[model samples]
Target: MYKIVKPLFFSLNPEAAHHTVTGGLQRFTKIWGAKSLLKNLYTVEDKRLEREVFGLKFKNPVGLAAGFDKNAAYIEEMAGLGFGFIEIGTVTPRPQPGNDKPRMFRLVADEALINRMGFNNQGADVAAGRLKRLKNKNGLIIGGNIGKNKVTPNEEAVNDYIYCFNALFDYVDYFVVNVSSPNTPGLRDLQEKAPLTHLLNTLQKLNEQKESPKPILLKIAPDLTDSQLDDIVDIVRDTHIAGVIATNTTISREGLQSEDALVQEAGGVSGKPLTKRSTEVVRYLATKSNGAFPIIGVGGIHSAADAIEKLEAGAALVQVYTGFIYEGPALVSDICKGLLKNK
Candidate 1:
């Protein structure tokens, strides 16, 4: 069904199609028994998919990656589509038009996407409000992936993160600090040692004061070197954050099967070409962190094999973005069931 819908969707602007599909899903579930209807198509509840991390028990390990439902709009609908978890936002303290429209593109030839969406989202407060209304069930876990606005300069980015952290604290099961996306201007600079440590430490300090501190994880880029990853290990240990999501999108264009011009389209590359590099990052982080921190692996995972590869690489959980777009809802069940099978 997604294969059939892909052409029609691909015909529209990537961002527009995204809203249309998400909005449609939101409405689709409102009809009587619609969720049950989707369950027949996409649902799979199996023990192998159950994962425990950061004192939270996931119903399943396959989570919809952040940036898919940036505002927490389709949590219930997507949850019905068989993801054990869904992460929303890279939301900021304030809403802003992200980089201009053509910012999102498909490299279908490579089963990939290049997006400079720039953390475009409704403010954290709004997303938190939406999440607050959702009836929490043990079946799904939702993570809030937070980022600063493009207008927030690197030096003061921690304030923006703190705002989001405080706002979303009660609503999400976990939080991902996103300083790694390649889209927002000067955002990646926060990944450097001193600044990165400062940001995570600020959040962890705030988290400690809460009666039930949310699990905080840092989302990183695949472009970091060994020394940088070592720095990340140091940051995670020193700050005592929950874990790391090893890897956001990558800036690397190597081995892309897409046209040269298309590959050169400016943005972070995500999908098939990202698999190896992302997995490598996951493995590297796992090795460096020495199981002291958990990892949520994302990037280029499109199948059961791909999902398992991340688990084998030491991911406590895995997320899908472009793969979900290209392969559709069935991908979730496939990955989950595959996890069950191997177990």
Candidate 2:
């Protein structure tokens, strides 16, 4: 079904195609028996697929990464596609319209996407509300990816993160702190050693106060140096945070086959171009820390082989966003099926 519709979707503008696909799915599921039909076609259920990570049980290790359903609106719809988990939001304490039009671009030639979406989301409260109202998550683990508001100054960024953390605390199973997005001005600056430590420590301190604290993971960038990653390992150890998401997106555009026009687009690049580097990052973190913490590998995972590479490289689980767009809905089942064969 997705193969039949791929061309039509690819013909639309990348961002428009996204809205159309998601909106269309929202509408399609309204039909009688559609949800179960989709589940039977797309979901791969097996006892072997289950994974336990960070004190939570996942039906599988394949997750829908942050940014795909930024506002938590598609949890139920996306859940039908058979992801073990779905992360919503690069959400903020307060809502803000992200970067202007054409913020998302497709490098079809490279099976990649460049987005400067600037964490455009409907705020933490709204996402929390949606999660609160979601009737049946079907055992899907949900993660809340939190970030500062665009207007939040770097000096006070911790406050912004804290606000979002508190708001979504009860709704999400885990939390991903996003301080590495290139689209957010000065946001990556927080990734520097001192500030990053401060932020995580603060969040961790608050987390400890809770009766049932959730796991907190740091989302890092692929551009970090080995020394910086060493710092990341140290920070996770010091703060006692849950783990790390190997990479967010890369700012470096080294080898892209797309036209210079699209390649030069100002934003973070995701998809195939990120494959090697993201796996490299995952391996580095896993090796550097001696596998001390879990790493959720993402970026450029268009197939189960790609997902397994990361898992072998030390990622406990993996995620897909750009790959889902390029590979269509069946990518989820294909990946799970591959894992079963390989396992």
- TM per candidate: 0.97, 0.99
Q: lDDT per residue, candidate 2, 1-343, as tens digits?
A: 7788899999999889889989999999999999999999899999999999999999999999999999999999999999999999899999899999889999989999999999898899999999999998778999999999989899999999999999999999999999999999999999999999999999999999999999999999999999999999999999999999988999988989999999999999999999999999999999999999999999899999999999999999999999999889999999999999997
Q: After superposition, how far is residue 203 of candidate 1 from its true place, in Å?
A: 0.9
Reference-based TM-score, model 2: 0.99
Report the lDDT tens digits of candidate 1 across residue range 1-343: 8888889999988889898998999888889999898999998876766788999998888889999999888888888988888999988999987887789889989999999888888899899999889885555788999999888788899999999999999888899999999999899999998999999888988999999889999999999999999999999998899999988998998888888888898899999999999999999999877888999999999999999999999999999999999888899999988888898
What lDDT would each prediction earn against the true structure?
Answer: 0.90, 0.95
In the order shown, what is each candidate's alpha-carbon RMSD? 1.1, 0.7
Model 2 score (lDDT): 0.95
TM-score of 1: 0.97
Candidate 2 regions with alpha-carbon error over 4 angstroms: none
Worst 10 residues of 1 by lDDT: 134-143
- Candidate 1 yields a Cα-based lDDT of 0.90
